[model samples]
Target: MSFPGVRRCHAHRRAPLHAGHRRRTFGGRAGLVLAFALALALGVGGTAAYSALYGSIPTAEAQDRVVVRGGVVRLGTHVYLHANGSHGAIGITRVALVKKCHLRVYLDRQPGDRVVAAVAEEDEAMARLGVQAGISGGIDVVDVRLYRAGRRVCANDRIFGGRSNLWISVTTLARTPRKPATPAPAQPTVPAAPAPPTSSVEPAAAPG
Candidate 1:
C-alpha cells in the first residue's frame, strides 16, 4: 500500500535516533565511574595526610601519666619588681633546673626513660598539671607546679610549689658544691723583746 522510497526514509531516520541514544547512555556511565574514582582517591589522600601530620603527637592520656624522675629545683634569688620598681623584696621565683629544658620522665610501659622538652610559660604548665601549695603530696614536677602560690617562676621547664629546696618527690637533687672558706690571716709575730744588751762583761759575773 506504501511506496518503497518512503519506507526506506523512515528506516534511516529511526536508525540514527537509536544510535545517538546509545552513545549518550554510555557516556553518562563513563562519567559516573570517573567521578567515583576521583572522589575515592581524594578521600584516601586526605586520610593519609591527616595521619601523617598528627600521628607523632602523643595522646592526652600519655601526657597525663608522664612522671618526673629527678631534677634540680631551686628557689629563685632575684627579687620581683613591679613596673614602677615597687615590691622588690616581696618573694623569690621557684625554678626547676634542666640542661636545655629537656626533662627525663618515666612512663608506665617504657623500658628506660623518655625526655620531654618545652619552652612554655608558667600558666601553660599550670594548666597542664594543677599546682599545689606544697610538695608534701608527691606531685610531679614536669613544667610548672605551684608548691607555693603568689610566687613568680624562674625556670622555663618545671615550677615547684614551696620554698623548701628539700624536694621529697624528686629521686635526687644534684647538690651544688660549697666553696671552702678562706683561712684567717696570721697575726704578725712580735719579735721577743731584745734581750737586754748583754754587757760585754756579764755584769762582772753578777757583781761577784
Candidate 2:
C-alpha cells in the first residue's frame, strides 16, 4: 500500500496549498499596512499644507495699517480683518474690488470703499478663500518706486520705490500714520574744553 512515488506526489501537492495560505495571509497584512500608511501621509500632508498656506495671509484690524505685498493671492494681497465675536457663529466674507493701482483702502467695514478680502477668523477666511481665483483684482497704488541714497522720500513714495514685497497699507478712512523715516546712525560727539577764565581786574589792559 505504501508506494514511495505516490506518497511523494501527494506531499508535494499539499506543500503548495500550505505555502499558498501563508502567502495570502502575508499579502493581506501588507496591503492593510500600505493603505494605512498612505492615508496617514495624506492626512498629515493636507493639514500641514493648509496651515502653511493660512499663515501666509496677513491679518489686520480696523484702523490698523498693514503692509501688503504679493501674498498667496498674486492679483494683489489678502488681509483678514479681526471680526467681532458678536457676529454669530462666524463666516468667511469677502468683497472684491476690480480697480487696479488706485490706492484703495478699507477699515472697520466702512461703506463704498473697495476692499480685497475681510474675514471673521483666520481659519474661516483662509479655508474659504485660500484657493479662490482672480483674488487681487487690482493694484493698490501708482507707480512702483524704490528708495535711493541721499533722497527725500514720502511713505507712499518709499513703498512704491523700495525693494520690499509689501507696498500697500490699508487703514481707516481717517489719515493713517506715515511710515517713520529711518533715522541715520548717530555719531560720537566730543565735548569742547571750557575757555580759560580771564581776570576781571584791569590786569587785562596789558600796555600803559
Candidate 3:
C-alpha cells in the first residue's frame, strides 16, 4: 500500500467533485421550472390585456329584459356594462326565493338594447317562472334603477335604482277602467193562496 494519507486525500477530492456536479444539475432544473412558470404568467397577462383593449364581446347576447310592473324581484340577466366612455347601464340585483336563488325582477330598455338576465336550465327555470307569476302583487318592494347620461334607463320594478324609477312597468300590464259590479237578479215570490175559496163567500145557488 502507498501512503494511507495520500489515498484518503485522493478519495475526498473525488467525492466533493461528484457532489458538486449533482448540485449544479439540480439547480439548473430548478431554474428551468421557474422560467416556465414566469412564461405562463406572462401569457395570461397578455391575453387579459388584449381582451380588455379589443372589446371582444360575445356574439350571443346575455338575455332579454323581463318586462313587468311594480314587482320587486331578483334579476340576473341584465349585466350592465359601460359600452362607450359616456354611456352605461344600471341593473338591479336581488335575491330569489328558489332554492338555487336565481332572480325575480322587472326590466325595461330600448327595443334592442340587452340587459343582463339570469338563465335557468331545466326544472329550475320552470319553478322560477311559476313563483314569480304566483306572487304577482302590484307592489314592488325593492327600488333600484339604472341611469345613463343622467337619464333614467331601467330600474328595479318596485323602487328607484340610483337615478331611474319603475315607470316603464305599465306596458307589461293592462290598465283598463274597472266597471262597477251589477246588482243581483231579483228573487221571485209566490203569493199566499186566497183563503181556500173564502169560507165567507156565498155558495152558488143550484138551478132548481
Name the best candidate (by TM-score): 2
Clashes of each: 6, 8, 17
Q: What's the TM-score of each model vs. the native?
A: 0.17, 0.20, 0.18
lDDT of 2 by residue, 79-180 (tens): 222234532211113323323332222223323334444321112222233321111222332122122343422223223222212222222221243356
Tens digits of lDDT, candidate 1, 1-208: 6786675444444445565466444357686566556656777454434434444333432444344333223323421111234312111123333453322222122333333432222233344444332232122333333333555334332343333232222321112222357999999998898777665744455554
| CA error at residue 186 for candidate 3, angstroms | 1.3
lDDT (Cα, tens digit) per residue for candidate 3, span 1-208: 6785575444444445565466444347676555556656677454434433443433232112233322222233332221245433233233233333222343332333322222222123323333222222122322233333455432132222222212112222212222457999988998877866535778899999
* Lowest lDDT 10-residue stretch of candidate 2: 67-76
**What is candidate 2's CA lDDT for residue 74?**
14
Badly placed stretches (over 4 Å) of model 1 are 1-72, 78-141, 147-163, 166-208
lDDT for predicted candidate 1 compared with the true structure: 0.35
lDDT of 3: 0.34
Enumerate residue pairs that collide in model 2.
69-166, 75-136, 100-139, 101-139, 145-160, 145-161, 146-161, 146-162
